[model samples]
Target: MTHPFGFNYGGKTHYFVFDSESGSLHNVDYVTFLCVKNRLSIPFEGGEAEDFRALEKEEIDEINAELDQLASQGVLDSPCTVTQKKKRTGEIKALCLHICHDCNLRCRYCFADEGTYRTADKAHMPVEVGLRAVDFLIANSGKRKSLEIDFFGGEPLMNMTTVKAVVEYARSLEASTGKTFSFTMTTNCLLLNEENRKWLNDNMYNVVLSIDGRREIHNAVRKTPSGADAFDVILNNALEFRKIRGDKSYYVRGTFTAKNLDFCNDVLYLNDCGFDQISMEPVVTDLPDLQIKKEHLPVIFKEYEKLAAAYIDRRKNKDTWFNFFHFMYDLEGGPCVVKRLTGCGSGCEYLAVTPRGDIYPCHQFAERKPYKMGNVLQGVSYDRNVSDVFAGNIVTNKPDCTDCPAKYYCSGGCVANNLNFAGDMNKPYDISCAMMRKRFELSLAIAAIEACEG
Candidate 1:
């Protein structure tokens, strides 16, 4: 049986019981918190007995009665059963187009191996191939009227010509095809000059600038091929782009590694740089020293708590407000049921296309031959076996995620990360899962704090 998960949080100011299945959050007093947290059938004091007030027998009976009422109302300690969704193919919604498999800077921990993807030399997507990709997206989009194409790579700016061509080609077809195209691009800012900046600001719906927080933090890994720090150039370019970006959406995305356990400073640093929409993701790598280990969980958890509190403080002040991508969770409205079941739609609705037209489940899975679903010319050629596997990769189908309280929130985690680390797409990396759970807990606590403040 799936019961409500209760925990004492909010700096001891509040206790919460989160209903994972139904998405209900309950704020209870200390006694009720204990009753629900311990899953006691009858009110009993054992854990936290010393910390909590001594309960009289009559008070315990009242608590038990309240618990029974909640249980009967299906609000507490409720049973949950999830049915596995049947395998099926769906229309593609988005594509991450690797416009160039080359980068100007050489990042030490680049999963793409400095844009070569382990290849001997860099490559760029030809304009013809890009046009074909646009056509492929339009043709395969089916009844979907809105389509998204993200220009990704070691650095898309390396082949800015093809990026612009693909955008124009897709835009030309929108009227005839009765479809709307939204473009997004991720760049390192090395080539974000005046000419391209103006074009991108006008055409691109959203832009993601890659900057790893503080100067030392960013310069430590991201640097020019000449082995010189490119932090100043990238920061200046990003600031310029942000100014011209007007109201169009953009994110100053950063990656935190084991070296920066106090990554909250990085987030705040980005915010101080005038980039309000910020995202700081943990680096996923196999490098021994860079990998976040089991011993690091406590520090990481503390850092997350620190970030959450600062985020709450900022939100309380209108002038100093900013958005942290990870902490932005909508409790009242979230992803659709289908999205929650299928996770990120990787290897299915959302696929990544390499410069050479090879398709992978997502950008992280790109260049991995075994995960090559197919090519853009022929479209996704996922065999029935592979298709069925991806189709059935739901939280309910995963043993580890079946009972996880964060299942719905994370949607089985990232499939590409799962395949790379766990050797199974359905299985999640335990460390990542733990971090995600902590984030979820803190997000809920923050929400409660906000509600209380209001």
Candidate 2:
């Protein structure tokens, strides 16, 4: 019912319409915007309506007719639904390999249990294990010529030898197997020394550097085991890495929590740090003091608005511009219906391999024994019940998402988060859902401003 979202942004100089049904943004004049937004005759009256005083009845009627025509074309709030493609079966396209279940930093929000992943012994993935994982991806790829391998971990660089071996092995088979491999690594960058940074720049398709914003805020939660400041080292290394990386894809990723409700400043700080591509995510945790509650939504929403306004300013002034990951919405030719319906293809097309070679739905579900699909050595052999559950929990199948205004935009959100919060994959975490909806609105608004300004 909310397909066409109408709003005023950019200090109210821009009135825009976002057609979610078609993934289109339209920059509209005041009269037309008012017609679609009010869904009735004009509301202007008195001296405040002076600018529109000369608009004849016939002009108003004509604008109404145009709006009606747009609605019928599914570029407005059309009743028609997008057809969901049949559920995908076996064709793994991406793998997150846990290179090591160990890390150098002791981040307070470390979900991997300070690098052990809840395991007693922090272990580095054996070189053979990493090689086997590459082979496993190649063998089960099923016509997927371009495959993705993300070297993930408590810290992937901890197992540099294994990572290099896997990449080399995967590359060795490219010509013979008629397949190509792209690599991505997510690291804290403490180990991004000269040699390692050079090698990563040459091989990785993308690199994710972890740093919280502002020195004080970052050092508050993220530090070395010896309780020393970890921010400076990581920041310096990230800058160095970016200098040599040329134009390849990389982002400085940060996390916001209850401690940092005023997170907009952190985002701006990252932008000022010379990292052009950036992502700032809310921390997902069960720790009561750190959890984002309903009361925090208003503050968070306000921060988002501040960010959006800054985004608009940056877009207009190119010198201070940076890409905020959450706001990067492709309004033209987005993913197909199947991709939208199935979310990230976590348990299906994408799976994570732990340091021990065990496969799980994704990295977040790595140590959870019940979700284990199988191991790289044996291939995917596990309970059909788990697979069926994953296949059935598409956006269309999720009761909560079926009628949501942002269903197609978010695709039912993160499955792991849903499971952890709502205790069901089909049920979304309300906090995340709210944040996502607000982000979608702001993203559309930002796009609308750009479209109009251009």
Candidate 3:
């Protein structure tokens, strides 16, 4: 069906219609949207002229003409939405390796159960496991000439020896496989010493350094295993890494908790700390200490407003380089959205493998049972979550999404977030939905304002 989403700007209503089947976007006015939407309710072919009898004849004709144009562009809803076939591309392309199920820090809001998978003992992924994961990535990479594997963990740096060995081993297979590999590692920066930093600079394609903004806020949660200072060490490592490899190939990633809704300050904190690339995403958890409550939502919106203004000021000075801008405005077209049909490529195009060689759809599901797609040795075997999520069928297939206009844009939200908050992978929490809607609305407004003013 042609999904129509309505929003207001400059005291006028506008609609953004998307055809899920064709992956096309239609920009139209409120009247056109309503008329077409109304017309599509039945098997009617045109808007009723009697509805606009109050207007002058010429105005009625003008509106009718616009309605015709929208219909021609196929923004009008299909007469039979229920009977349409779903577009499914459950291709596997990317792989994430849980290099180790161990970490050094004891962060307050850690979601991975302190990286031990909620168990007492923590194990570092062996080099052979890494090598096998690399082989699995290449084997399942399909026709894609380049394959990517992310070294993830409680902290990947804890198993630096295995990481180094894997890189060399992956390279050794490139000649025979004819597939090039790109590597990324996410580290908490505790073990990011000068030696490790220099080696990673030359070997790794990209690095994700995780830290919270501002020292006090960071220290409240992220701390070393011995309960000592972690913020200072992480900051120093980031600075040193930037000096060697620069910020383009890396991002200083941070998270926002309920305590810090005014996260604009954190963005500025990172900018002032000589970081050109930074990403501060909202933490996804149900913990009261970290959750952004309904009351906190307004402040977070305001923070984005403050951040957008600062971003504009920076842009005027030729310093605007924000990451989420891509979400605000897309110069190129977006991917085919199939939320009514499936979730992300958890079991299909993406796989996250544990140290013991078991594979799940994504990193969040890496060692979790039932969500397990297959083991690295045996390859993918089907389960309901894997089939439903990886097949591109999810919450959009349900009422909460089907009734929401913004579903096309969000593509039914994250499975991990839903499972964490909503207790069902197929159901989405209203909190995340509202946050995304506001963010999308605000981003669109900011993009429009910048385009006009700049």
Q: What is the C-alpha lDDT of each candidate?
A: 0.81, 0.82, 0.71
Candidate no. 3 TM-score: 0.80
Q: Tens digits of per-residue lDDT for model 1 on 77-124?
A: 666655756534557778899998889999888888888888765789
Cα deviation of 65, candidate 1, in Å: 2.8
lDDT of 3: 0.71
Worst 10 residues of 1 by lDDT: 1-10
Q: Which numbered prediction scores highest in lDDT against the true structure?
A: 2
Comparison by lDDT, 2 against 3, better one: 2
Candidate 1 lDDT (Cα, whole model)?
0.81
Badly placed stretches (over 4 Å) of model 1 are 1-12, 40-49, 86-88, 378-385
Candidate 3: which stretches are off by over 4 Å?
1-72, 75-91, 325-328, 336-343, 377-389, 392-396, 403-405, 450-453
Give each model a TM-score: 0.93, 0.91, 0.80
Error of 3 at 391 (Å): 1.9
lDDT, model 2, position 251: 89
Off by over 4 Å in 2: 3-10, 29-63, 379-385
Residue pairs clashing, model 3? 91-349, 92-348, 92-349, 93-349, 341-392, 341-393, 342-392, 342-393
